[model samples]
Target chain A: MKHLDRREFLATSAAGIGAAALAGSFPALASAADAPSFRPEKDAKLDLLRWTAFVPSDQTIWDENTKKFTAATGVPVSIQSLAWGDIAPKAALAAQVGSGPDIIMGWNDDPFVYPDKLVDMTDLVDNMGKAHGGWYDNARSYCYDQDVKRWVSLPVGCTGNAVNYRKSWVKEAGFGEFPKDLDGMLKLARVLKKNGHPTGFALGHAVGDANSWTHWILWAYGGKQANPDNSIAINSAETVNALEYARQLSETMIEGVAGWDDSSNNKAFAGGRIGMTMNGISIWYNGKKDTPDIFPDFANVTPPMGPVKTHTVSNNFTSAFVFKYSKFPNAAKEYLRFMLDKPQADRWVTEMKGYVTPALKAYAELPIWTSDPNITPYRDALASAKYDGYNGKPGKAAAQALDEYVIVDMFADVCVNKMAAKDAVRKAETRLQTIYKRA
Target chain B: MTSRSPLLARLDSPRVLGYLLITPAAIILLGLLAYPLLLGIWLSLTNATIGKPGEFVGLQNYATIFADPIFRGAALFSIFYTVCAEFGKLILGLALALLLNQQFRGYRASRALMLLPWVAPTVLSALAWLWLLDPQFSAISWLLIRLHLIHSNIDFLGSGWGARFSLIVVNIWRGLPYFAIGYLAGLQSISKDLYEAAAIDGADGWQAFRRITWPLLLPITTILVAFSSIFTLTDFQLIWTITHGGPTDATQVFTTLAYQRAISGGQLGEGAAIAVSPIVFMVVLAVFVVRSVREK
Candidate 1:
């Protein structure tokens, strides 16, 4: 057998890796520039891959705008839409394999996970800063890459999780308005349950769905998850009361609500089964096509305070990053600039209707943005919104290790089932401690 | 005396050639299948999460699986689902096969349609079931409610019993065709002469079937039972597509739990551990099946 020399093979592979690294494709540097659709001799080609579904709200409207932008400047654009969950693996693999898309959208929270894979857009943010009035703090915080002292994924829509209620149901329940606080919510839930409209914070197995629960409830009760110091403050009196309130709410809920995941709740609400729910308005927007009866005269409000504080949490808003594999960094910045521009951003806000809130402040001045009733509340909420993990260490492993859904379930076991709240909290806390310690 | 070198070399020569011919197959097995299996076994003892390589933590994953209420519940639920589902399939498939085997006009055409449910993709079947099982739009439940068989619409996938019962129905539906086809093959293999001999011995149709038909089908029965047990125990696709071990993890099986640990919770090591424990049970069942069948 002819054996290969280990030293030579290692040396050759290292060199190849180094050469690939310096090539600076994905996870390296520079963004891709858009080119003419039909290869024009004068223009350069660029690709834009977004970690968001290019829905009617932003991408389509941008396509119309891109036509005009192309009319003036003869470069072409290609847009790739993907789910946010698929972004990192795609980006990472594209980097490793040397064939990733040029410009990809990521949530502001994404830089923490893959900072090296993106260009430091701090200069881009600073450069683009004058053109835009301001950025939402929560959305902007996640885009900054502290490692390189620059911004990464440029902020787009700013969303805060809120309670979406049916105006028709509130009136039928003998309530003049949406429940303003925890007590009001409790009272309204009991009223609604008695009146045939059961209410609940629909629970199920989805991990991101669990985060929405954590932010609106856990944070309200002072459950601090900021690490390297995870204090299981979720076991306090305020939290116990929150859990108790959750339990009482559970009692007033429809029988099958415990099994409802996000889509299931959306179906429940759309069918007028659930009186209200806590989740993203994206579901509400997307549901209209299939379930039009579901979206009528609905009111979106800041998640009500639980006798403590009404805090908002969103898993993330749509975000983008210039991949290291980019062929044209300058072109990517230009596209991001165009994305933030007036009729473009406003059209996204208007067309997406209520699905997204524009990251740029001045878009609120635009006609379509201001005129939309369903979308306006989200704009107001983001003014005071704190991103669930904005600016913090990714702390994903720690938080995951804690397994918030399972923890919340355990807590709910005590709170709703009257399984001894202290015992439940203690078990959950011990679990949290073990997770945090391991992390 | 034979020359030592010539004799020794000849002993090795043909074996080396045989190994050489099988080299590609061996390499592929090692690289693709065997390595992953061994790696999974290794991972089961460790505390590996996704993306992060983990430290070995002895039998902690197995211990935790037993200690966790969720796993214990899932295990019992899985066993209940498997036993009920397999038996239901066996009974239904056998009955269906018997009916199809009877001489009748248009029986050949109807026999072909029976294979559709078995052959249809699990995802498509699940989607069909999802529609039929929806509380508001469920065709079956709606019919039952309309006919006053049930007072109100029952949430078929909500309650534990409802979900388990629903799984039994689906599992039976999916597995019936295999059993039916297997029984048909077994039935066809039986010589008509034996039945003729039984009839000549003053045996009635029922008595002939009991003595001649049942004994002949024994070997096939053992094979079918063993095959169905393994297949049913390892079943994941249909139930996952239907409920994803849903509403309360009420439909939790070992596979679903393993999936949650691996994908949802990102606990690969724990999942690998959970995934493998079922094999021990399956192996024991398989051995018992083979041993009993062999003794007969």
Candidate 2:
């Protein structure tokens, strides 16, 4: 549970710094020297399906990296960027029909949904782990299939969530900085609302924003969807406590947050309607470009500490998985390796302005985290991050509960529907039981 | 010489040619509609998830979904949505049709303008409605506030009932033009002489409409109602684009639920079951309406 301060983080990343040094001296040579090479098939071509990123530079740099890969290796790669919500159905259909883009950069637990259909990336992952410092434990949880004893996917990175608030507004609300604990957050929210600037969080079926903070709050209150044994264990006093807290929190929010999706809060924040919301760095990035007047007034910080006094993990994690049905598997593997290598990943992360936190531990020392003091907190976003299932295994059951927005709805039912906390907990428990039992 | 062959001669026969003439249409229907419908139903009866061919479970998926509160809510909501939207569209469309049928100076232009909602893409229109209903940035809210009608913005999609009502309103708004245009065509086809005849018998406008117009329009109304009911029951895009079935799933319809479970959740069988659950309602409605129209 120890958080590494900036100084300590930099100090502990000696190995990462060494890799950076090598990359600086001979970027091409160092990458080629350490990577486990794959000989692409004759005339191998790859098609990659990726979600459209929130930060514009993420895609621009990503496409540039892919072009670099093609220039280095004689293989041609085509990338298709789809909306965030559409990728899941497309990936599922591709998995079901046994044909699609050779590589899919899918969201959390997507590889778990169709483990058997994905290509085994064990060697590629092991080599990458060694070449970099190592993959984070959370990334391993996402990409590795414990049942199969193989890595079914390679984690690309995660888009971490943080509290984005107007600095001036926080000061006006009688806070020096954003609150760091549950009680303080509630007080700050109340004050902000009184000051005519209420905080808003997505209470709807937002795939990213709602799930991220809701899960964080639930887990922070020591509630979980299931136990280590994967049993339904959500009907607990802790869950009720979480629900009650959410109910109190919702009262301090803008009027329509319950119906808001991922984009709603962003618009609200940029339009100066809400004082605070949890989101990725896209809001700050986009605000800098479009709303320069408001840009200096806002700041980003880590999510508030719950009563448990421990930081809980929450993020919109992403990973890449190649399907077994792919005709050019080696080429796909090579392309992933080429993109995830330090030389390319460093640039992508740096250009993204810390929008995407690296899944590999080695990239923690990337300049993006240090250059901007505002983006410093995001560097540790995945440090304590865990997979979705948390206490249980990450699998279809967990993914289903997530896809159905079980936890988000549990909090929302109490917050927006004004259902009794215990009743909402019972309802969520039943839904989770149905999903887990079915799975 | 070629036509003298027995097969060619048989093809020239009226019965054989009649079958041959309808072959393509039948094949197309079977291929496009029947095949997918059967596949979906078949999938529903299995334990199919994504990527794996599943074993038959024999309606177990149906039992599971029926017991699910979310699915049950979606089922009830779909029915409510269909009935309410259809009635609203029918009544309002009939009114618009009647108004448009009048010989106003700009009747042609007004009719064309009225069709914009239906003619515009559903997704695009729904997106516009999303902005219009936005709790914070809504133009309607701005107008209402400026008019001093309400002191605050209406949280259109914030609560369960609010979201449900908003979705139904949007559905009606988008679908009204279809009903209006169809009823207009039906109204125009009615003879002006019938009204003259009713007047000769001392019938008022309402009485004349009840006696003549209602009877003549009943057939078209039945057909329109049947088609609209089916479309509204299976409605996906408008609700999905607007809410994604949120506010505790107040507006979750069968199509969205099916999509969430089957496509997003990767439980193809369960999703298929949810998708096909509305077949009974649709079929029963269709048959009853068709039979009633035929009898009348």
Candidate 3:
């Protein structure tokens, strides 16, 4: 830290030279150019960069409702389907290069990680708060910096981990109800393995899995990363227990569990190699629609209780960001506000089925969502889920530590039998402190 | 400046044309290499960002990297990987070159086939290896299983050792062909009369190769080894596609670490520092190699 002075001297000298050049040109360009102000292209024309899995067709839709969304919303979602994992880096890169999707559908942590790189919607939040009948308060808070007083993103959807089971398999295993505790769950797991039902999990080195496993166990032990102060406090007895239990679970984990990333796990759950795993309603929704026979008799419920409480990591709570470069701040906010409206959100969830459960109360409270079995638990889990540390603008170092480094290498190190639970946590903690300090 | 006169005129005739010929390369190098190098050195002393240019922070970035465990691990791992890769490429490539230089059946076809690995784009080769290393669908794993060479399938990219081993093998495979071709070309350029003269003096094939061929090829080897060291030191794709420097810091090279630090960590200054650290050594090694080869 002490070295900053000398470095600042040399750097500032050069920056001053560059700044002179930039200042000389920028004001001239701004004044002469036509971009003094321009509104976003908001003609009720919504643009969505959909995930690859969400794009369905050519297989014949058995449901008539989806056909109607296409027909009615002639807003015909210019659906560009990208692999979900590719969304962040691609979006981040595009945002860096100054041309990205008007509306990119991604996972939860993006808004926090890319907040400054996004549009602030305080006015939109106000207008849409009333416009959308006041979105679920928790969802709204997750999408913004409540303390900073800005709506960094609009909560479009929500996802949460749950006890997804092959209802038929559990019935045959002589289990009447889902496992309520760790011991019961292990006993059932053993019975299932003995009966030739192999449990599989996808612990791939992806950001989704990073959050997924953290939430799976953190909530399992009734622990949270943030205290009331929102500081990292994950290292605790409960977290350690979850770590040990996660390792033990790794032993009984099937032969090819490591090979299967997100897709493989979805396939395992659907194809019957795995009876029950913790996942979002999207797993079931995707399965039921794509591979109907593999869907099986299903159920979604709370995950097993640790000594603390039974909770699942809340998911699907994505925050929408407006980049600082957006020519139309009002229009961008307007577009986000439109997505917040109950009818639009309801139509989205209703059409997409249970994949993206809406975060807006107006949308969640709709009769369509209230009646859906798969989406209901997402609503319930939102009450207790914890968020990782990204203050709406996730940095590269923090991003690497969380997404590329920590989860795959550390958590999976224990989860896949490479290292002891305690050692992995210790190693990760040491590395994390250094990385976080730099941040 | 006027000392040479007419003698310098003839040499200077080609000099003007040579500069013209190399001008494009110089410009490209300046933009891609020189500018980036200067930019990195500049940024390492500051907190320059993608979205915002931050205030300068001096040598703190370098100090922070030294203090950090992950950076240390990655740095150490990079040295290990580079050493292993360079040795593997040299030894295996030389042995293959020796074998291929022999008079054999389909000699031209065999010689032509050696160029395949060197010619393939790195990204494609890495992608292919990813498939072959796939635990579930790995053709190699399937063959190994059938031959009873192993137990169940191994997750080549899942464990630290497995991931590192996979990268080394892929790099060796890609590196060997180029090495062999370079050696083979060097072999062809050598005068056959030396070998004949040695044979007339009662030298066997081994002695002829050792005394004559190896000595003459020293120049080539010096150049080859140094060039490969530079290439291997900065390699980003092979490690990226194979392990992404993963399963931990096992396969993380300096270049990959620099990228992860910059783009993913958003510590552009730190990343720039890490990226440029290699240049100090790289420049020294390159100079040494050029001088050593020239002297030979």
TM-score of chain A of each: 0.77, 0.92, 0.76
Q: Kindly list the per-residue Cα lDDT of model 1 for residues A1-439, writing each as its tens digit.
A: 1112335433543554466468752221111111111112235456776755434556667667666445433557787767655564465455434566777765534444445656666655654454567776755556664445667777777554667777787898888877667788879888888888787565444444545654566555544444323454445665565566667777876654444444566666676777777767665676567677656656777777665555545545666677666766655655665566653555666676655666666665656535656656666656656554322343433334423354446544554345676676666666555444433
Model 2 has an lDDT value of 0.87
Candidate number that wins on TM-score, 1 or 3:
3
TM-scores, all models, native as reference: 0.78, 0.95, 0.78
Q: After superposition, how far is residue A355 of candidate 2 from its true place, in Å?
A: 1.0
Clashes of each: 20, 0, 18
Which has the better lDDT: candidate 2, or candidate 3?
2
Across residues B173-213, which tens digit of lDDT does each residue of candidate 3 receive? 98988789888888888888988899899999889988988
DockQ of candidate 3 relative to the true structure = 0.20
lDDT of 2 by residue, A192-290 (tens): 999999999999888899999898888889888888889988988988888888899898999999989889999999999999899988888899998
Candidate of highest TM-score: 2
Off by over 4 Å in 2: A1-30, B1-3, B291-296
